[model samples]
Target: MSNLLKVIALLSLTVAAPGQSQADWQSHESILGAILEQVESNLRHTGEKYQIDVAPLDRRLQLPQCDRPLTVARLPGTRDLGNISVSVRCEGTQPWSLYGRAFVRLSKQVVALRTALRQGSLIAPGDVELVEKDATSLHGGFFNPEDVIGKPVRKSLAAGTVLLPTHLTTVKLVKRGQQVAIRAQNTVFEVSMAGIALTDGEAGQRIRVRNVSSQRIIEGQVISDGTISVSP
Candidate 1:
């Protein structure tokens, strides 16, 4: 009877203890780190320089080890670059999901004035410099230096101030009452006419013009400094 009892004890030990049936599962840290790495890689693919800050998951929280590699993805409609949430999931038999938040600080090279600029001062390459700035912080910031060059400032701006789209006018390509060559084009054919602009317009902007020969008012897009186009 004692031998039988000893044999039963040995059998219990050999059968494996409860909760030790499978390999140790992944820790919360490892899973969270994997998710963060995927998020960083996705952000980098956008081609914008950014400093990423991912909020850490609760250190004490327990997570089951995934037999397969864990999958990480951004939540739908969470495409914005600022504070955002991502989904981390394990597709194994013990499936689980969690949301992680990340703060992405995007940076860009934006145009900034090198010298104090007064209202009506024309912007030149020499007067502006491309400076690295927090992209999210600058509302309506100007990116292309050429877009602002030759544009007159609408308000006085201090030296080193970041340029905004609202601070400059679109360089006027056609002036009111100026004679402009009007070109009408389509897939089939092209035609040209002489017209007088009745309203000022920048390149690609629609403006009112009068046909010089017909004396009929028409709307056309300013194609260049001295040219406009109308659809027939």
Candidate 2:
């Protein structure tokens, strides 16, 4: 065959190659879709209703296509939810990698006040309610109501305000001048007596109590609400 004819044939064959046009370059949408899938999988345990918004890549930039499947992974130290970055990589013939920035929002039910509460007010079921909030913003959102029930507020809080550990105080189980059952017991025997709490205290806190029968004052640990246990 003539050299000119051979050159023309080779050029034609290259242009007609199957899947070549599709494989020549990578699209931004494909990369963003891969990132969304991976970020969703990683955040499955973080929350159920999760929203992901991957930022659009630079319009002028172009990336080589990969022959192998693309991979997405969270950047080191990336948070479970919030503005995060993921490593998007291609291990094909033309290896390439880049970071994709995305904003992740997760929703969850958190404890919130149903009514305004004053400082030192004890929490009750009627005073609080569950409200859906952005889990990413709630740092440590409380799910169970029992955690805050009966706990006193640290300061005045407005209605509809989310409840956090900083908003509540340790549950005071015993109160000063309140009648409490004083019990002293061992593995073999037990004795029960009536007493008056001399000071307010929380569970495991030691406070003075006066024996109602003997009129003797002694210190004991607050075991439960209206209950104190003493040792010999």
Candidate 3:
């Protein structure tokens, strides 16, 4: 066989063959073979650590179990590199392995609260704040207090809201350049409130529609027109 196999065989013979009977030697060799196979497999493979919820072995586990992605605190080394440790966690599920794939417990961070304050950009529990050093550099500047202070921040921004610092900084409250739609087709029209009117439109939502053809203003559902209608 190969040199490694020969070496192991000789070593096993020296350690156990003399002390045990012939049958015992055969059994030990079989175990050695299995261990060698595992070593060889590990040599050729690579792995990473992921925390996931594992189902208990006692229960019937299902495939494609949706689990939260774990926050990776550390990473493993390459197949032939540094001191790597494949990390895995167990979730509420137990046992973890069916045949080979097992669910591991994992932890995730979520942004609970977010706002721009003069002190710096405020974030909730899991939000990660990235800081850059040079503004002119390709990475640009870090999240600064001036950038977020006095800026409208959301307690819970929608999925559409960009979380990146660059994108959030460029956002502004709709003011003069805001585009408004008019609604006139529906009878249940309403108008903006008196104090809340951003423009000339009255607040409290009164139905108002302006006919382009006759240049006449008609009162209707303020919101039903699908566009902002004016009082006629």
Candidate 4:
């Protein structure tokens, strides 16, 4: 009789152990899911529509069941888009912390080459077209077609490739050893002179030039093709 009682007690504990573990697993998933949903909600409220992808929780990790709701927060310096991680914590008697990764994608219209482009090719309105793309994964693509029009390609790009700042450059306006107009202005007066450019420069770039009349070397910003402006 005594042996039978002992065996029944052991069997009861064995059956109840698995039930408790299952409950803990469910609680763990609930907490992690809530944290990821918060991350998605925050991204959606940024005024831009985003498609969020969250990684699945590791099945091997077992967390204790919490009687209270879990606390979720973004890691320090986290942005609203791209791949990021969030921290989740349980503040109940059995406390725990975890980090989860999520990917946020925003759709944007960007400029891409309609056909294969060669290095030094001038970008024309017909050569590029606007296409909807994932802005987060563009790796810094040019969104405005106007910003790239007339710019020279720095390297060859394949068809359907997005244009990036590193892929294009402004046309050089001031070539080395060329004569250019130098304009100087002050609060009271303005002056113009002829100067020879010592270095090649594009519009908005600063370059060195020698004034023809004064025989003075000066640094000025290239304002246009064959034109440089110096401060008074």
The number of the candidate with the highest lDDT is 2
Q: What is the lDDT of residue 77 in candidate 2?
A: 91
Best by TM-score: 4
Question: How accurate locally, in lDDT, is each candidate?
Answer: 0.78, 0.82, 0.31, 0.79
For 1-232, candidate 3 gives per-residue lDDT tens digits of 3344344324322232234444432232233233333333443432322233211222212222214321112233323222222222213222121111122221222122243333234443333343322122123223334443333343435432324354343222222223345442346755442212143332335434444445454553334213355442
What is the alpha-carbon lDDT for the whole of candidate 4?
A: 0.79
lDDT of 1 by residue, 16-74 (tens): 23575335545666766876787688776768788777776554344566778888888
By TM-score, is 1 or 2 better? 1
Ranking by TM-score: 4, 1, 2, 3
**Residues 16-82, model 2: lDDT tens digits:** 2355564576888898899888878877775368888888776644567668899888879998688
Q: Each model's TM-score? A: 0.75, 0.74, 0.18, 0.76
Candidate 1 segments exceeding 4 Å error: 1-25, 46-48, 177-195, 219-232
The better candidate by TM-score, 3 or 4, is 4
lDDT, candidate 1, residue 198?
Answer: 96
Instruction: State candidate 4's TM-score.
Output: 0.76
Could you tell which candidate, 2 or 4, scores higher by lDDT? 2
lDDT of 1 at 3: 46
| Total backbone collisions, model 1 | 1
